[model samples]
Target: MFRILLGREGRVWREALAAVLAAEEDLEVVAELAHTDEVPVVAARKRPDVVVLDHALPGSLTVPDLCEKLGAALPGSVVLVLMDQRGGALSTALARLAPRVGVLTTDATPWQLVESVRQLVRGETVLDAKVAVAALTARDNPLTDRERDVLRLAADGAPAKEIATELFLSAGTVRNYLSRVIAKTGARTRIEAIRIAQASGWI
Candidate 1:
């Protein structure tokens, strides 16, 4: 059986999807979660073959960052992300994850979901055609590459000092970059800036 781990904030939605996947003869749910923060930890412990995550799962890290973490925790496992109608803020960085990271719309049938999981486990890429086209044609990134670097670290809950250290810059410079990011995104705060950048697929 293929060990599966699921992460979605909605109680009803998570369990319902779990039931659908579990009913399949070749799959077994090793773990289920309601928060993105729990995914890497649980997945590390369970060592599941596939992890299915919802983009809206409540947590500090964005879906892409969380997926990176999960990948590091279990390099052999694959991820199948369920995107909302707005394409769940698909990004170029995400597309780079390729076969290790599959994408599907939330409206996909239960059969599609099950098959996608199996395909991911079989080392096949499963990207929704519509979302891929939409993401490719989306607006260009507004922030500079440096600004995006800072915001990406910020999205992962890194403090200004930590971001500065990682980027080999001063903390004040990091803060300045964050401030510019917020202004460029027309956001009221740092978190809002990160969200705007993510939703716009800028980072």
Candidate 2:
């Protein structure tokens, strides 16, 4: 039998998911967690075969960072992250977990979750088709490479002169780049432009 742990926050939602997984004759629900901090203690004690976690949690921390630690705590157990959207706020960095971590969107049926748990136990990567399509269909970044570079620094509150020094450009040129970036991002100020780009996953 495959021992499973539910690491989502909501009681009702966790129970609902538990009911779905319980139907699998080969899968067993061993524990449930409402917080990321509880994962290490429970996984160490239960040593479950799989962990089903929701990408959104109560704390300011992200589930991806928690996944790294959970994977390390139980080397034998693999993580399956459920995304609420076609593609969650998943950083481009999530590609690193492609081998041992699985990602499924919220629209997934109960059977898909069950099968994904079995597949993870078998050591397979499970990624939703919507994830692929979302990546492909994302709005293209409108900023030029240099503009992106400048905006990256500007986003961190660096002034034009400081940014110019870092990129080895003239201070006047850096200001010009910031102006163009603000216009392209359709923001009234450099700060607003940086915010827009960051929100869009461009920076």
Candidate 3:
């Protein structure tokens, strides 16, 4: 049998997913979790062959970090992530983590979910067609880590000096980073760049 563990919130939809997989004679729903942190402890005991992950699950680590932890602990286990948006940090970073990762949107059909799970068990990678195209066509996020940090603080209405004080950098250096952020985002001003980054899910 192909055992599955669901790591997600939205109890109603998750249970509906369980019902769908339960119809398959060779599939079993081993466990369901409301948070990402539960996966390590609960899944360690169950040793499920697959895990259905949600993008919003809470943990001390980020989504990609949790995936790495699960991948290492579960050995041959794989993940089928229910994507929230078409592109974001999680989707962008996925390729670097688990080769067996399956990406799909919440709007995907039940049949698609089932097929993806089966493909995962067969050691194949699955990505929704829309996700594939968006990920392929999306512009590479241009902001570096420090640039993103400086811009994120700026977005929160922090003045350059306050940002520099918080990050332990000189005021002039903060302005330079802000200028690069504006140019990279093709925005007219810092506020505009912040809007672009927030809209693109980069900050």
Candidate 4:
């Protein structure tokens, strides 16, 4: 049997995944974790052959970061990310981490999820066609790369001063980027701009 580890915050989804995996003849869920912070520990203990992760966890860490870390920690393991249909950033980040990992949409049927997991176990990357099309059809932003970077930092809940410090720009420059992002996204406030940029997959 292929051992698997599951990571997701939602109790209902976790239960559903467990039920689906349990019914598979060749797959076994060796462990399940609720938070990204617990993933490393659980992985170290379980040493599963595959890890199915949810991308909507509450933390500063992104799915790509988790995949990178897990890849390092368990060189023989494969990471498969489960993302919401509208999770643009998650899709972009997973795409960037391709070949090392694969992505599946939450709307996927149980059979699809099991098949994706099997594909990942065979060292193949699988991306849902609808999710791929959605990513391609997302709006392209007019903001410069630096402006997008600033907006992403803001979306991660970083303050303007911290963002400026991290980007090595003056606070005023950070504010200017925020203003440009707001205007490009047609949002009234920085928070709204961040949300819009994230939703459009610009960041």
Pairs with backbone N, CA or C atoms under 3 Å apart (clashes), candidate 1:
none
TM-score of each: 0.72, 0.66, 0.70, 0.73
Report the poorest 10 consecutive residues by lDDT, candidate 1.
84-93
Model 1 bad stretches (over 4 Å): 143-182, 186-203
For candidate 1, write residues 30-120 as lDDT tens digits: 8999877788888888999999998656555667888888788789999998875454245455677989999888899999999999999
Q: Model 4, 82: alpha-carbon shift in Å?
A: 1.2
What lDDT score goes with residue 168 in model 1? Answer: 78
lDDT of 2 by residue, 1-203 (tens): 98898988789999999989988899899998887667778889999888888865433235667778877878888888887443323633344687578888778999899998888888887888876555455466787756777876787788889888877789999999999998898999888998887667565
- Model 2 worst lDDT run, 10 consecutive residues: 86-95
lDDT of 4 by residue, 94-196 (tens): 7777666888888888899999888988878788776677666766547775676677678878898998886678999998988888888899998888778
Whole-model lDDT, candidate 2? 0.77
> After TM-score superposition, what is the CA distance of residue 9 in candidate 4 from its true location, in Å?
1.0
TM-score of 1: 0.72
Better of 1 and 4 by lDDT: 1
The candidate, 1 or 3, that scores higher on lDDT is: 1
> Candidate 3: lDDT of 182?
94
* Global Cα RMSD, each model: 5.9, 9.4, 6.2, 5.4
Q: lDDT per residue, candidate 3, 1-203, as tens digits?
A: 99999977678977988998888888999998887667889989999998888865644445566778888888799988887564565466775553578888888888888888999889887877766665665567898767876876798799999989866789999999999999999999888899888777565
How far is 54's C-alpha from truth in model 1 (Å)? 0.3
lDDT score of model 3? 0.79
CA shift of 192, model 1, Å: 13
* Clashes in predicted model 2: 0
